[model samples]
Target: MYLKDVPRTDPNIDPATLLQLARDVLETEAEAIRQLAPRLGEPFVQACRLLLACRGRVVVLGMGKSGHVGGKIAATLASTGTPAFFVHPGEAGHGDLGMITPQDVVLALSNSGETSEILLILPMIRRLGVSLIAVTGDPASTLARESDVNLDASVEREACPLGLAPTASTTATLALGDALAVALLHTRGFSRDDFSRSHPGGKLGRRLLLHVADVMVKGERMPTVGHAASLAEALLEITRKGLGMTAVVDADGRAVGVFTDGDLRRVLEKVDNVRTVGIAEVMTQGGVRIGPDLLAAEAAQLMERRRINALLVEDSDGRLVGALNMHTLLDAGVI
Candidate 1:
């Protein structure tokens, strides 16, 4: 390639300086995390054991940026089968401490290991006989020294060029908190069902989590027609129920074929007098359907892939006990 075709570097930029700065920042942060991995000795295991055994919630406390990380950690703990909540250190001194019980375990965070608000509540926490676990950079600092168990979250320096912003330190603290939550989760044998219980509003909770029985249509709302009925009768049933389709059933109330709006359109194109034809003659044999026991999410996938608007819900004997449409899934928020 010609020199003119090559991209020109900025005149003022020094590539070596930029690369060195990036390396230093990553090295410092990596060193902090590397230190934490081995520190998962008996103390860390004991901490997980304690939290797992606790009958009450885990109370987290921190100041400023640490507080934000603490909130996220608490949420992670709660969603992973551990009951926990973040208590602002400043607010804890002003009556929010009432939320904590003697049965609870307190996880306090402070980079300097000397947050006044956290220290202010130490005496009260002690009086309540609550277990105190501290996460701080200094092991010998007041908060760390006074805590029942201190987790060392020290870092060499901040990733910031000024060495003032809490970049690498906060990152290490958050990673440590995540490690603790996950370790406790595994120890407790927390399952996906448990997680879904804590997060019923999320998408994952709706998929593998929510049961089919919770969102299925039942009783008179279902559109159904006898298998021997005329095509006109099935169409009237579909129109009356407003489900765009009707379940064709046998004499024993079992599902046979399904007559949908699409079937009607195709049949109408072939024969102008579809009203006189028997529904079984024009209905789709072995149409796509679902059991009431199946997940609503699975039903939605089936409908989408098959390009169908409704499904005949059948029992083990192919009995048409219920019916569902795309609208049903939409209304239930299963889609």
Candidate 2:
């Protein structure tokens, strides 16, 4: 039942008491995770090795609250270059055990080390010659002893006032699972590009995978003016493109400089007439150019660092190909 539906211990619960209890729960869970740090040695290393050497997907199995944590662990592993999926232990005892093959490695989770559904399928798992890794609170428990290697996820005590809930134990187990996933990630040499590929629909993917060309205004959409063009002509190009800047190209069509709204403001103050001034005299020489193949996020960082709003995109030959500004990267979600 929801907390609102459950009967209260007292008609009026003190706000101070509720806040203190919440703090205590957090403290207990934090301590439990800290205790796991000292226990990380050979068993943790063996687990990582098994995961790294596995020819097939890592199958995660657990029951109750451990099963919930196992699902998250499986997702974390899969996203971080490890091939993994969670299979319910209850379903595995039915027909889902077929999902586990001899080539696969099984990572099981159990606080008591004796989850019935998981233990029931242990013999079949062993028959398939699958390497089993257990995360358990009890090292001497049946599931822990039966496994090839056990990682201790034991916590001192539950955060519950009654001493029977799965608060601190679950937190410790989740933390251990995270530690395992991160360790495997580092061991696999998983890169940001690898992670972005796995999470293509997310914001990180957009920031990492998107290149300058993918988000730049190109061809007819790009604003450009010849080096010999008047300052007024460059202003027209900038207004037409609405990018606040225009690349000044030479006879060979290579970008030699850039004229921006900022330049116009400076020219308006110093030059007698904007129409009489040549674009080259007023332009910022080779203003903040970027390669079309560079990452858009890197482009954004460069813009922020240089304190400029626009960037001209050039080819390897220094030919003007496109142009973009802070707004372009923002539109592409690179910022």
Candidate 3:
């Protein structure tokens, strides 16, 4: 597609000017985020403590652009160990307020703290005896006045030339929300394992964590054959298990060689009678293997680097205990 086809910018605008406009906006908002660091005082600490001590879910509410930021903050909190959800101010009055209980905390966001929808729900929230927290540019607004705690998401000015669009203010509010979530995360001593549990489908959950034992084939599903078995016997085990390979084990049940479908084709070229050949004679010795305790993602990396599929899962004693293949990785969402 041609650059002129893009809808956001004027077709005749200079590319450098467009880039500079975006850069300026980002720089101004970045400065706004930086300024929020020193402003974290007693109120911020108390907000973190309240969120940490919350027994019920965090119900975030706002209108317009503040609602968008509130939704994002709720998602971040929910994914990072804090149970939370967004409650649109308009919807809360239309029966969605049933989702909130007295044990829950309501975090309301409004730049002027006078957003009609959010202000309208203040009475219902108070009547439910729910704890109230407000994020606003104005501390004197009704939302802040009625809140149990107030978070100042105020900014000096917006990056927009019109000074109407939410730019610096939204950035500051987002940064403050992140600070609260992170502080609560630290105070709760949330670990990477806990984070992974919450994000099992994400890339971060796959890389630094998730173990092979959590995804590998085991017991009767694993393909194995005695070291003295014929190539045909090994092939039968591979076909029966459908892992594309069979682990050959010694008399002591230790892995000695692995016979894959690739090995079968290669051996067929060299052996006059493949059916009579011993698997040990045709198999690759000391093939790439992994421990069941290893990460499934690490196994994928190893297989990719070595240009192979299927790994014999060995115990610490080198005894074959399990087996896994590319299909297993795919099934476990490790691919």
Candidate 4:
């Protein structure tokens, strides 16, 4: 891929130099975040307190690259139990500032702590009596000085060779935002279940929320045979259902045992007359089973631990309610 515009000065730089520069950029950003850790103090606590006590949403305001970072911070906060949304500082000064209310808290981001767009709305935010939290490199700048709590996101230098881009500064600001979100998540006692609710379309949501019953074969689709049935009948049931196994149930419709292809191999080694042998005589009694309400992920773990490919789902009375094979979990994206 060739570019339309070339500098003509040495566009074909050595690959080794490019790789080293990339490594250096990563190191610089990492060091900036490391330096931000010890700076946590009372201001961080005050910010969390203000957010926790807020009755309305947290309105995040920023400009340029800081706006991008603020949007992500707001999303993380919202997904982790805090109500938040980002408002572009440029848009807010026009008409978006009306979104802010007395009950809402304002979180503003500015690498220079003097972004004109953000500073333009300070008087209106003050009129609303909304608490302001600032994330900035300059603690003494107007935005920081006016904020109720100012978080220092200063870095030693930019990762860019020209030291003109918002590289290390943006990384430090993002890390600080993540720190605040995580602290609030812990303080609010957020759980995996809560996270799953907000992310129901993702793989983690499926693993956490999908249950065995939701994916298991039930009713007429389940393979089962009577305990008094011959080995041939059990094998026929297993073949007809294609689950490689068949549940051996008592006359009362409760599972008494299970017979699988593994059992068939053992039975064939000794008993030549498969039609005359009762399934109960060779079946594994009370095979590993799970309840209908068990999470699919837990069932997957149980199958892996027991070294089995299938499981029976039973109800409170131990009656076979459903059956599931490893393929079921795979299809459901549980494993």
**Clash count, one per candidate:** 0, 0, 0, 0
By summed lDDT, the worst window of 10 consecutive residues in model 2 runs over 1-10
- Off by more than 4 A, model 3: 1-11, 200-214, 217-225, 229-245, 259-295, 301-310, 315-319, 325-331
Model 3, span 1-335: residue lDDT tens: 22223456556877776787777788888888887778768888778878888899999998889889999999999988899999888988899989999889888889999999988878888899888889889889888899988988788778887688998998899888888888888888888778888876766777547688888788898888998898888888988989899888888878888888888788888888768889988888988889988888889999999999888888787767788888888877788
lDDT of 1 by residue, 275-295 (tens): 789999989996786887888
| Alpha-carbon local distance difference test for all models | 0.84, 0.91, 0.85, 0.91
Model 2 Cα shift for residue 226 (angstroms): 1.1
Put down candidate 4 lDDT per residue, 217-295, tens digits, no spaces. Answer: 9999899999899888888899999888999899899998888788788789999798998888999998989999989
* lDDT tens digits, residue span 1-335, model 2: 22233346777866776776677779989999999999899999999999999999999998988999999999999999999999999999889999999999999999999999999999999999999999999999999999999999998888875667799999999989889899999888899889988988867889989999999999999999998999889888999989999999999888889887887887798988888889988789988889999999999999999999999998898778999999888888888
10 residues in a row with least lDDT, candidate 4: 1-10
| TM-score preference between candidates 2 and 3, better one | 2
The 10-residue segment of model 1 with minimum total lDDT is: 1-10
Quote model 2's TM-score. Answer: 0.94
Off by over 4 Å in 2: 1-15
Candidates' RMSD to native = 5.9, 2.9, 4.9, 3.2
* TM-score: the better of candidates 1 and 3: 1
Estimated TM-score for each candidate? 0.78, 0.94, 0.77, 0.94
